[model samples]
Every structure is written in C-alpha cells, then in structure tokens.
Target: MFDSATRRELYEFTRGTEKFYYTSGDAEVELNDVVYEQITISRSEIKNSSDLEKDPLEITFARDSKFAQDCLRSALEENVYVKVIKFQHGQQSILWQGRVVSVKPSGASIVLKSETNFTKLGRAGARLKFQRTCCHDLYGNGCRLNKADWGVQTTIKSVTANAIELRDLSFDDNYFRLGMLQSAFGVSVGIESSAGNTVNIIRRLDSLADQITSDADLLAYQTAVLELDQTIATRDALDENDPNYEQDFADAQALVDQKQEAFNIASESVFFVVAYPGCMKSLTACDRFNNTDNHLGFAYMPEDNPSTTRNA
Candidate 1:
C-alpha cells in the first residue's frame, strides 16, 4: 500500500540489504525473520533514488510519515541510488534481484550449499576432528607429509571484499597473517574497516538492530561479514600471499569447523544441521525424520510448517 516514492525507498533499502546478504552464500537465514522485500509501483516515479544506503537508525529518529517523506526527498535528491534486495519465497528458496543507482562496489553473495556438501562432511566422521581442511595438500608437499593427512579448513574461499585491507598479524617475527573462518555456528559474521563508509554503516545498523533483537541483528551482521569474504576456504589452504586479501572479514571458518567438530559433540547438533531443523529439535531426530540426503549416519528431519518455532 506504499506510494511510488515510498515504494522505491523501501525497495532500495530492501535491495541493498539483500545484496549485502546474498553475497554471503553460506549465511544462514531462518524463516519468518521479518526481512524486507522490494516492490516497484510505476515507471514515471523513478525520480527518487539514493547514491548510498541510508543509516537504518534514520528511520527511528524520524519514525513518522513527515520525516519519512523528508528523508525520501533528500534521498531522491542525491547523485544516484541503488535498488533494495528482498527475498520472496518463490517456488524455490528465497530469490533476490535488484538494480544499482550510481556505480558502487558489489559485495559477495550469500547462498545455501546443497545438502550433499553436508553429507560429504558427515562422511569424514571421526576424521573431521584434526582441526584442518581438505586443502592441506594444496602446497604440493606441505612439509613432506601427505597433504591429505594434515588438518584443513572446511569452507572454500569464493569472492573477495573491497573494504577489507589487511594490517599485520605476526608471530614473534615469524609472522602469521590475520585470518577469518566461515562455517555454521560461527557462520554469521560482519563488516569492519579501519577506514571506509561501508563498515561504518554496518556498525550503525547492527547496533540499532541489536537493541531490538540481539540475535536477529547478529545474523544480519554476520551475513555482511560472510559476504565480504571473496570465498570460503580452510584457513590452512587460504592463500595469504595471493595479493588480494580482505582486511575486514568474519570467520565463517569457525562455523564450518564447528560442524566438523559436531561429529564428536552432541549428536543433536549433527542432526540439526545434517538432518533438518524441525526434526533435530523433535524427539523424532532419532527416527521419524526423513531427508534422503541426510540419511547416512544420521536420521532425516521432518518438514516444518510455518507455525513451527522450535528453535531460533
């Protein structure tokens, strides 16, 4: 029921948010999370656009219709703007699409890996424990040991972030690079910068979102962090010498690593990720659950309905 200008504003905000979120393919977004989606009204009212994403708190400070109008007016007057990203559960998973206003850097996208990847990791069974990734063998020798024998990270690096600029992380002059990991439990990361506009914007929105729901904001914040990463890779195999590195990034590595560790932790965590969200939380995790994909070593989880809110 929003008008053209208002709709555009909402669209831009929603698109920007989604663009930021989708770049992080591995980021986890639960259902009914109250995410905003974008919708356009007409062709003529394309006048209102923004060169940049507005601080979400601005909505709170001016949480009235008049303020919203003034804010929209100022936003439209700017140089150019970007469209917002919103997910509508279409036939498939959440789908996102939008346009950019002025030219700006596009961050990485967020995607959910197929259930097969989960199955592969689950196959490692007791072996996922070594605190490493499969790429330990990438270096040819890896100290003459079977590269496969050493520990490797779970996720693989995909795209690079523009905002991230590496500083220095050394070890008694031997020096190790500052590293980030992307996985499941620690999957939600956030953006950061010693200097830049994006990180600042990220901090502000996350801070405000936290006031309302720490968990929700944290998820949104992490989604940004995971997207900044060019791609996921085990820390061991991640190429530090590769010239292009993101200074600001979250360790989704930890999340994947945690899953690798879950092989040993409570079987429930395994069922939750490996099986299904609904099935794991239920007494059925042991049997009734049934995802043909998750059937190995683990039982399948049942399909959840909209009313189901067993776990956050």
Candidate 2:
C-alpha cells in the first residue's frame, strides 16, 4: 500500500498438505493471517502460443533457502503445484499456475520447471483392452466397490525402515496385499504385503518416522484381495492321514469364519480391517465381491484361436 506503482510477487507451493509460501520483496507480506516470508525468488516469463502450446514456467529459489533444501532432501519434487500472484497498484492477480515437472539445482540457486494444466489435457488417455484381468480401477465406478467399506483405522504398534507393525488385527495374512496404508500425518504408502498385523511397504517414507508416535493411527485400504476360498478348499481337500495336514490346516476354518463374522458386523468405529475376497476378472472373483452383475471384463470370451485347432 506504499506506492501505487510498487510491484511484488507471492509464490505458493504445495504438495498434499505441505505448503511453502514466499514473497519476492525485501519485507514479509501477510495475507489472510498467513505470513509469506521474504525470499530470493524469481520467475520466468509466462508465454501463451497460438498453437495452444503453453510454455513451461521456471521459478528459481536461492540455493540455501528452505524451498531449495526441501527439494534436495526429496521432500518436494515434481508433484508440487505452484501458484504465482502479482501484486501491483494495490491489486493482486494470478500470474501463473502450474505443476512442477522437474527440478534443477545449480551452485547458487534451484530452478523448478513446471508445466500448465493444458499440457496434461493434450496427453492421451489409456485405451480399453480386452484382457482376462478386470481393467477397472479399485474403488472406481466400474469396480463398484466402496473404499470406505474396505478400510480400517488401526494404531501403529511399531515402525521399521520398510515396514510398519499395526496393533492386533483380526484379518488374515495377505489380506492387504497391493493395498494402501495412510499414516495419521497424511503420508500414504503402497503396501507390498501384509502378514498378520505387519505391513511391508513398497518404498520408505522419509518423514513417516518423524511424524508418527506410539499412539499414531493409520488407515489401511484393501485394494487387492487374495483368493482365500481357494486356500480353504485346499485345506479341506488335505488328507487326514498326511503328517503335515494337521499343522498346515490348523485354525484355517476358524479363521475364515472369524473374518466373515467381522465383515458382517463391521462399522465405521470398528478397529478391525474388513477383508475383501479377491481381485481379477474371473467369475469366481466376481462372485467373491458379490457384484457379478457389475463385472467389467469379458470372461466368456474365447481364449483359443478360431482359425487354428491344436490337439492336446
């Protein structure tokens, strides 16, 4: 508000719930009670071409700044969204808006390369294919499964480099394979496999250890389900006289009954993780999900070549 001709810029960078605000002025600026720290930040020209090609925006930050340090520590990367606002003549207007696509760190500064949403619009969508596996995304419209019904809120018993041990869970082993585990701190990680209550993660979350505590809770979502019916069937078919049968099939039936009962009685407040039966486009999988009518795959499609016949 000092001079009508005075100009300054505000930079807002966000990824998930993490945010960084900076202002390109000698003094700090406060908007909506949130302070934007004064920092050495600048941006490249915003270009719009007649051919509908939006030029990428490059924002440079001082190499020793918090933003640059976050980038180097792998906290902020290509997933970040950046918005630049220009304040001139006592008015504020959006200068540029885009997502960070790449980062380049030099000796003195770090430059974030971002592309506008128009670049995403120009990309092609995935084509549907006639495959044996269901093409529908988990919890997606085609899958017709509610994610909320398949998730459980549980406390973290312990944490390791590549895994997290959850508190006592009633679900069976491998129930959360290919699923998602979100920590209370909003850090979501892909589950590689789960045994009992221990969940192995696909990648290490750097900030998870610092953000979680003994009482930290996590939301586990069952994205892919293993075929438990097959296991039960195999256990049932085992010979009574087999030496290992008793040990191998111990509590198998009881475990199934326990899981089914839990599923039937599960509620939002229940700490137990409800198990989904299976994943795939097979009729058995569809039956397990109890959504056979919504199955998106062509399960009846002929697998053999019509033009050639082979003897078995």
Best by lDDT: 2
True-vs-predicted CA distance for residue 194, candidate 2, Å: 1.2
For candidate 1, lDDT tens digit of each residue in 1-312? 322222112222222223221111122333245333221121111222232132111111111122222222222222222232333323123122222222211222211111111223334442322221122111122212222332222221121332222222111221111111112332222222222111111212221221122334434444544543423444445566655433312355665555444333322222110000111212233132232222223122233674543321
Worst ten-residue run, lDDT, model 1?
A: 270-279
Q: Against the true structure, candidate 1 has what lDDT?
A: 0.25
**What residue pairs are clashing in model 2?**
none
**Candidate 1 RMSD computed on C-alpha atoms after optimal superposition onto the true structure:** 26.6
Tens-place lDDT digits, model 2, residues 1-312:
356587878999887688888998988887778788998998898888755355889889876575664554343323688899987876889988888877777656778888887787887754678765566655656678886777776656666998877776677676677667766544455677888878887777555565443431222112111234555676688788888777767767676665555444332222332322235456556676677777766655654776553221
TM-score of each: 0.16, 0.47
